[model samples]
Target: MKWTIYQLLVMIGVTFFMWGMENINNENLIAQPPGEWTAVNSPLLTFLATGLLITGFYFIFLFEVKKKKNRFQHPVWIYMPQLCMAIGGVSFVLFLIGGTIGPLGGWVEQMRSLLYLILAYFLFLIFLFIFSFEHKRNRSAQATEKTIHLTFFWTLMLFFGLFFLF
Candidate 1:
């Protein structure tokens, strides 16, 4: 993929923005004892960090994925694991959110504790549905003829659906 000056500048700006958000999140470490400002627990900083990271990903997607023909760009087994890390990062954030909010109340609040699991199941379902649809549509962007088997994929989806619904 070709990089441009604009993209580079945007990237640099995002990096700085993320760093500043981190400092905001960890302002306690920046502040010292004796008449100094300490960290304030601001929800805004966390939200801004979330927004910036997502914006960065979308920026990358527009330049890298959407612009390319056959956006898969690599074989599933080779590429998916790396993409999983990004997915995992989001999951971790959701986990943190759920964990933090889970203790605020009782049984209804208990749902917060399982938020990640619930989300993961839906995410898996949607991902599989898209994959299956793409396969049926012959949208396999891979160079080779082989792709992930639909049977195994659907089986996983079925399990998640059963667990989620029943």
Candidate 2:
């Protein structure tokens, strides 16, 4: 079954939704009391998770652009997702740096929260990107696209949820 670009985009959108939901829930869990939930105390793990999430989104953007035959040139807004990913990555790195320096508790936590919010915006961009890219597509490809989209979405959410929640 040949897949239309729209079908692929829908799959991506569904993925973003699923991932965002998981992320929100996970973040909530992490914000809970320390004794009740085993928070990730290791800075290395925090940094790694943030880096990987940013990297994964970046790859997704690159792959979509390449797959679309450079059609991304149409509008300037199309690049927003990649930009958000970059911002999140930078913010996370800054949080890591601040955390290591000591006496920067306020700065580190602020940076971390900012990064999380930006990551949420990135998910919105992902949704838009998929919608814009999938204006016209065949139905036959929808099933496969849906499966992959859901898989990636849930996987990302689970990974981030685990990292953020406990």
Candidate 3:
């Protein structure tokens, strides 16, 4: 049997999806008493599931990019969108599906919070877009540095978001 990175990534994605589904459904493969803390009901599990799914699809897109023999001079820039998408998408999903049930336990409260989170995420997207566009236009060291800075900024945002969410 032949294996490729794509296949491996897909399998890992599928595994993550299955586990996430089980977690969401509150079904544990392990035997435990009913009133216990399981990862099933956690918001972080939902976030992880959403992020992993995005990552899988991104890898498939990368496979297509490679298939066309289009090489990136700055691979980090290419990955920035994936990171942005994963975080933004997860935030949206968490708000939509698990919002009221999460830390903020009311629809109105969650919606208000969502508004701010969305606005911040949108701002980050805009900055990323501008940096990427400028980098492509000028291919300058400064532009590249700004894009890398944005990536790090996004990662830091991810950690803070998780901390607050959890």
- True-structure lDDT of candidate 2: 0.50
Where's the lowest-lDDT run of ten residues in candidate 2?
A: 131-140
Clash pairs detected, candidate 1:
none
Question: How many clashes in each candidate?
Answer: 0, 1, 0
Model 3 residue 42 CA deviation in Å: 1.7
Best by TM-score: 1
| Each prediction's whole-model lDDT (CA) | 0.47, 0.50, 0.52
Query: CA lDDT of 127 in candidate 3?
Result: 47
Model 2 vs truth, CA RMSD: 11.4
The segments of candidate 3 whose C-alpha lies over 4 angstroms from its true place after superposition are: 1-40, 69-166
The residue pairs that clash in candidate 3, if any, are none
Per-residue error for 83 in candidate 1, Å, reads 6.9
Order of the predicted models by TM-score, top scorer first: 1, 3, 2
The TM-score values for the models, in the order shown, are 0.37, 0.29, 0.34
Which of 1 and 2 is ahead in lDDT? 2
Candidate 1: residue 66 Cα off by (Å): 4.9
TM-score of 3: 0.34
Q: Mind giving the per-residue lDDT tens digits that candidate 1 earns over 85-164?
A: 56666866765675577542353254442432344344444443444444445544542123334423444455446545
